[model samples]
Target: MTVELMATAEHAPHREEFAALYAQVQQFYAQQMRILDADADGGEARWAATFTEDAVVELPLLPAPLRARAGLTHYARAAAERRRRAGSRLHHWVGMLDVRPRPDGTLHTRCSALAHATPPGATSKILYVCVMEDVLVRAHGTWRTAHRRITRDDLA
Candidate 1:
């Protein structure tokens, strides 16, 4: 019994650290969705701010991965244009986050993302369901996404 108690005590701090890391990673994705789904114009800039200066975003529909702030800006502009054309209200639902700390001190996160859209005078519909894999790092004492790869769930 004493040996078991010692082992449990040794693992307690590690468990707390893991919990804290998981919460920070979850918060980062939640903030990303909030900024991306904002109703106000120019929210793309806000969304981009959540990323690192040299962040990379991989979209399933894009030909190549978007890199850095300039690439993010371009993607944001394109997304805005598409939304404007569609005239739909957009929302993102993130679920089931799995976060693990890497040996390099960064965190790897995988989560399900469900995008919904509501057209004028119409009910909301699921636009797409995707799984997002991300590498997050701590910069300036805050967690920011360094890399994000989105894979659409074809079976869904």
Candidate 2:
């Protein structure tokens, strides 16, 4: 085989690996959005399931970080309640994801999302812009979030 063909063959596996990781990251965020869009019933549990058992979620709007499944579940429940109270539904549009492989065999991703809310008898309005930094690990052949820090542009 020629040198050029040999080089391409050698790089094929790495390309596929990156592609798989990218797909996993995309799927993880998609699942999160799905959970957020879901109604209150059982939504907290579904959202908590997207994280690892010991995951930590940091939200700028919260006073303290949410640690572990229980805290995450609580946050999800509270979010659902807030939505219910306002008769609002949120739509999150994710954009400009930067995914990198970490040295510790994990994936680090930075992504931005624009959130819009539609309230009763009102048109949808942009609620906030969020930039999320996340660390994801693969366990049992599936990727789960280990840590997430969400920074809101509106807070600045």
Candidate 3:
């Protein structure tokens, strides 16, 4: 069974909630960069922690994990390769989000996403467009992603 240690936070109000939500979103992508960048100082773990005990992630360019362990393993391999190949840098940009509170107190948030990887000698950015759907839970007065899914709109 997956652990719910990361799903404990609360939303005070609209303003406060948005503030927290925005932070979470920003952190989420930052962690992704960490995985790409290989900064293990909690980024990857925190990223995985964002999900629920039995959360799910769907990536068009990747396979869905049967569980968190599998997910982490897949990510580990993907990261190993991505870290190589001399490139300027790869970044993920998150856009306007639509966040809704579920009946069970989990937040369902969706946003337009763009993943850009710039090569060392490339003049253009390779962009990946998708809608990122996330499920966030509030536990122990903290908000973390319980689950996330990236539905690629158009692979580039």
> How high a TM-score does candidate 3 get?
0.66
For residue 126, what is the lDDT in candidate 2? 96
- Prediction 3 global C-alpha lDDT: 0.61
Which candidate order results from sorting by TM-score in descending order?
Answer: 2, 1, 3
Off by over 4 Å in 2: 1-13
What is candidate 3's CA lDDT for residue 15?
A: 56
lDDT of 2 by residue, 52-133 (tens): 9999899997888899988988878988898989889988888677677766788878889888999988999998899989
RMSD (Å) per prediction: 5.2, 5.5, 7.8
lDDT of 1 by residue, 1-156 (tens): 245334433544576766666667677778888888876788888888888999999998889899997789778877877888989888999987777666687877788899999998999999899998999888899888899999998743
Q: Per-residue lDDT of 101-137 in model 3, one digit per residue for the tens?
A: 6778777778887877667787648577888888877
Worst 10 contiguous positions by lDDT, candidate 3: 1-10
**lDDT comparison, 2 vs 3, better candidate:** 2
